[model samples]
Target: MPMSITLPGPAPWGFRITGGRDFGKPITVSKVTEQGKAAMGDLRPGDIIVTINGESAAEMLNVEAQNKIKQSPGQLRLQVERWVLMGHLCNVNLVIPNRPLAPQNCRCLHPKPIPLHPNPSLAPRPRRCSHPCSSHPAPPPIPGALMLPSPPGPVR
Candidate 1:
């Protein structure tokens, strides 16, 4: 089963890297706050975001392309981008929200337990030996429960 993680739930505020139009010129900005935090800042509506903290939006998007490489849901990371300053591209960084988590396979699936039974015959038996049937040989006779000895050897 897949589990959906709610936004603004456990992760920090979202950060962004913006680029494109700026005073009829192209530029970028690596970081910006979400709507909630943006209201408390001096951010303008026309600002371009580029990244948050130290990671670029394109890099983050690449990381999210594969589910196995994505960070745990709600984890925060740094963003990075360029911004127009004094008619020059200025790189920046900001903290941002991590992508939400979709449903994942549950690890709790297991086989049902089997009930036990009472009594000797009803219970499990000892496993048989795995020796092959083609190796049968004559059985040796026991001498008073002790092994027989070899004949005496020649003197030196």
Candidate 2:
């Protein structure tokens, strides 16, 4: 299994952005960080980061411009929109494995298409107990063990 990592802030991928608080401002690579290389794994540079872990990145920025707003500081699932020379392209999902910067001036690429099928459902089952507690008490004492405890009546 791959070890997970957390981003301190939202890092920018290579790409030009349009429309937003920073509308008309072009988001470029090598400006974000020294490790400005496009994510070698899934998302490439210039791909706009849209969301992290299902939460909309734009919405998150609206709430707080800090990258720390992520519920947990760890590997983040990102949703982004890739702008191609052609018209708008498909929304891509990316993963941020380290600390990222706040995307105050950036915009989420776009949301990806979700499949129509609903998730599989299963009935809830009772959980098993491993320790002794309320539901199950200790076993009763042995019957004959109590009969042997009495002492002689003080040398009467």
TM-score on alpha carbons, each prediction: 0.20, 0.29
- Identify the leading candidate in terms of lDDT: 2
Q: Worst lDDT window (10 residues) for model 2?
A: 147-156
For model 1, the superposed segments whose C-alpha errors exceed 4 Å read: 1-9, 12-75, 87-156
lDDT of each: 0.25, 0.28
Question: Please, what are the lDDT tens digits per residue for candidate 1 over residues 1-156?
Answer: 111112232333343333333233222223446574332332323333333333333433322322211342543332211111110011212111111112123222111111111232442322222233212111222222211111122100
Q: How far is each candidate from the true structure, as Cα RMSD in Å?
A: 32.8, 28.3
User: Taking the candidates one at a time, how many backbone clashes does each contain?
Assistant: 22, 14
In angstroms, give how far residue 35 of model 2 lies from its true place: 6.9
